[model samples]
Target: MKSETYKITNAVVEDIITETSNIKTFVLKPDKGLEFKTGQFVELAVKGLGEAPFTPSSDPGISEKIDMTIMKVGLVTDAMHNMKKGEILGIRGPYGQGYPIDDFKGKRVCVIGGGVGLAPLRSLLYELMHDLSRFEKVSLYYGAKTPKDIVYKNYVKKLQQEKELDLFLTVDQADDSWTGNVGVVTTILEDLNPENSIACVCGPPIMMKFSTLKLLEIGFKEEDIYLSMEKNMSCGVGKCGHCRIGNYYACKDGPVFTYAQIKNFDEIWD
Candidate 1:
């Protein structure tokens, strides 16, 4: 039988790594292992502080521990950043629909992420990396506000050196020491072949909008493009109506959706 969605499990913060000035990756070891798919999220909570949804940055193949990359954005996350290793927290999910990686076999995969949005995409990427033969090709296009804002710097550097995948990085502005591409994430989409390929995108509202437009402009089908919608979710389950997108509940029907699935929804670009 499946576990209850509302049942909270205790987890220990085994390690914490500062990814950027404002973002940190928390490595948590749950009392009971969390078996989650690539794009699913978990509801993490502290006793007094509130809970928020965050996708696991670690690979799903690693059941021993899961990594959550969080940005110090609001009250709950602020408290999370101040939290120390060995502290106990609550985890209540591996919720929502994940990426359809199984259907991607023998097809080229393109991933685009901006800033902390890379967190969820990282999980999918790791799963893809684990078995390169499952796909024809893989490409990653990432962008941040500045070099200092880049998360998972060291790991991304190693991915850049791997000959199996194509990695591209960009920033809105470049410092004196920076010499890489300086533009939006969509700039790299120019050279990618949309034929027999699928695109997965996650980022700020504006970024996701423009990225989707660019992908469509480059011949990718609406059904072939996947998007991670960052709707306001109070509950990981469908009980709360906070994450509703038109007739669908983001928490239940999706957090991961195809462009064809959500393209008709009002204010989707907003």
Candidate 2:
């Protein structure tokens, strides 16, 4: 029999890392170990403030503790940001389907993330890095509103030096300290070869839409491009229709799906 899906497990905030001005990464130690595939998300609940779905930003290989990188976007997340270490919270799920990393073996993989959307892609990145030989090439294209908004700043800098990975960074607007690429994330796509490659993308709806178009223009097949469709995912299960996109439920069927799987869905870009 399948395990209970609605049970909420208790977890304690172990540590917190500030990623950007408005984003923070919370380290939580669950009462019991939790193992989840990269790209899967969990519904994190603050006692009286309610809950919201967030993807784990830490390595999926480690279950002792999980990291959730969250932005203070709304009431639930605002409470999460203000939550102190040792405070208690509830966790449910590792919900929705994750990226098909296994299918990416022997092929080139390209990941593109904008702003906090990088949270889920970060998990997938670490999973792919764990098995470096599985793919011919691994490239990450990341963008933020400004240099200060970049998440995992130090780590992203380190990734640029790794011979096995190709890392590209961009900002919508440049600051005095910013000297790197200045443009949208999709601007870097011109340098990427879509041949024998699959792309995994997540970001604001506008960014995802343009990135998908760029990938297609450069030859990425619709079926090979995976998208994270995280809308109003209140319930991690499909019982609630809050996250519905056409016939599919973003929570149950996917928060991760190929462009082809949802291309026909009206208002997918919304």
Candidate 3:
């Protein structure tokens, strides 16, 4: 992979779409086009502060700007919350091979996303939802900490309206006012048939680990199960040693990878 660093001459904080308290969507435009794939991530830098790898939550085709729905969970991201509109930042490429959309053609695709991990998967969902005919069935299972924690609330609602697509939502624990499925994300996976379909999993380490296990038990092939490995990725171009999970570089080799690719790696979640 080559280095593709660009300055964010134009940046803006878009609407706080979901009232997920700690999570919000930021819409940013580059000085020039910063094209990338759905599963690939970019290195977001706040000058003199720090940088972190974040997946673009916008459609892969829309090169004008990118939307990153981030959760304020760490140092750099917390600093990001303090940033105002028009503040310039640093960004880089749409690296890595995304989901095998081509292979999924004419086949049902199942997407399971948990918490902030839903951001990257939303990019793929955006693209897939646009052209529903290209796919057989698009079933999405998204889980969050609570009902209010769900991101992309409007989009998920619209997806539910599409008869061709089935959207399953669950909350770990809900308030007295909320009524919906209550359990782990893996529990929702049981409601679907993994046979002859592609399964994509992204979430907190524990959620994804168990989700993968459940998918395999439901008959999804190991190679057919795609996982977006969440790790500390510094240099999005692979130079930084922060995202290394053995010989593999999460920034370069993944952020998105098949289970067959990294299942044997030691302490992958560590």
Quantify all predictions' global Cα lDDT against the true fold.
0.91, 0.91, 0.81
Q: How would you order the candidates by lDDT, starting with the best? A: 1, 2, 3
Per residue, candidate 2 scores C-alpha lDDT tens digits across 78-170 of 889888999998998888888888899999999999999999898899999998899999999999999999999888988988999998999
Model 3 clash pairs are none
- Give me candidate 2's TM-score against the actual structure: 0.97
Q: Better model by TM-score, 2 or 3? A: 2
Candidate 3 Cα misplacement greater than 4 A, ranges: 1-18
Per-prediction TM-score to the true structure, in the order listed:
0.97, 0.97, 0.92
Which model, 1 or 3, shows the larger lDDT?
Answer: 1
Residue range with the least summed lDDT across 10 consecutive positions in model 1: 1-10
Angstrom error of the Cα, residue 200, model 2: value is 0.5
**Sliding window of 10 residues with minimal summed lDDT for model 3:** 1-10
User: How many pairs of residues collide in each model?
Assistant: 0, 0, 0
Expressed as tens digits, the lDDT of each residue in 151-270 for candidate 3 is 888877787797888889899998896778999898888867766788888889999899999998988989988999988776566775777877788888887888988888888765
Q: Is candidate 1 or candidate 3 better by TM-score?
A: 1
